[model samples]
Target: MSGTLHLAQALSNRRRRGRKKDFRDAERLVKRLVSQELTLSFVPDGEHRLWRTLTRTRYQRTRDKVRLQNQLEALLEEAHINLSSLVSDLLGASARRRCMR
Candidate 1:
């Protein structure tokens, strides 16, 4: 029984490590996509104003925000990091501190 428990724990640890690696890869991919998209959207065309407005509007839409949030959640699941908690910690510690105080 004790041996079985130890084996299970080891397997869980390995799975957790794999998940973390996968999350890191996913996050990198998402960041790359965002950067590429932004680059394309910002190129100075005669329609630059239109593109800017569309990009800002897309990001502002609830549906779009939810989609991005879901993507981040999926990535965080793999990394074993709670996205909300991480954001809270960052906001709690940084420039927000100055504003809050």
Candidate 2:
């Protein structure tokens, strides 16, 4: 349960190494962190993690919806329907009604 998270550049910049180099590094890093000496990383708390997950999922779903709408428009064009030209949004209620004809 006790360990250190170090940046690659920070680890590479340190010049000291021994047989227990990795363990020593972890110890030093933890000490620095506990004393507020290490300030390189910002590990987010649970609320921030949840917010990030929700935002990413919303963004991905919006992208997928737009992609699918574009594909549907392309299919309509192939059949000489020209849905994109007639309506601002191919997925709109008005457009759906027109397509149902």
Candidate 3:
């Protein structure tokens, strides 16, 4: 027997119930979960969640590194240092060596 189940809200034809929603409505939702009434939907397993977390973190770090490099380049240009003009890479070895001077 499959012990795991994932579900989502099944779109309903019920009339719109607006700002009057309260704790009782939440209780109903819990009851649905208990009774396996929610519509089936994609739910990633533990391994997939871990993989997503790792990849997302790596992607975000890469973006942050690139952003910081761009900011540094802009700040250097604003200070009238045209290191990027002389070097193919602003943060490369040659530029950094020149900067150390």
Candidate 4:
């Protein structure tokens, strides 16, 4: 038995359409995968599941911050603001002073 877990999406066939066909396809696929020595993973333990959730949340927040920064820079550019050229971060003191004026 293979201990390594392999994750893959189910095959979508346009010709096959019912739940029975899907069940059959899934059964066949599992048999073929087992023959090839691949195993699907089960749910992780509590700690690992919590870690995954936290990491995913952090990643999403980072992405949102980056997206917001990009939008701010784009808006400033549209308004003919060049604070980015003067300061590395447009959210810093120099840019804030410029914006205040």
For candidate 2, lDDT tens digit of each residue in 1-101?
A: 99655543465336365565777778876677667675465677789999999999999999999999989988988999887888898889989898889
What C-alpha root-mean-square deviation, in Å, does candidate 3 show against the real structure?
5.1
TM-score of every prediction relative to native: 0.25, 0.71, 0.65, 0.57
* Segments in model 3 whose C-alpha atoms lie over 4 Å from true places: 10-39
lDDT of 3 by residue, 6-71 (tens): 566467313247764668666776677778776657889899999999999999999998999899
- Candidate 2 Cα outliers beyond 4 Å, as residue runs: 1-20, 30-37
Q: Candidate 2 local accuracy as lDDT?
A: 0.78
The reply for model 4, stretches above 4 Å from the true place, is 1-40
TM-score of predicted structure 2? 0.71
Order of the predicted models by TM-score, top scorer first: 2, 3, 4, 1
lDDT for each candidate structure:
0.53, 0.78, 0.79, 0.74
Residue 49's lDDT in candidate 2 = 100
| Top model number, TM-score | 2
**Segments in model 1 whose C-alpha atoms lie over 4 Å from true places:** 1-60, 86-101
Candidate 4 is scored at a TM of 0.57
Lowest lDDT 10-residue stretch of candidate 4: 8-17
Q: CA shift at 59, candidate 3, in angstroms?
A: 0.9
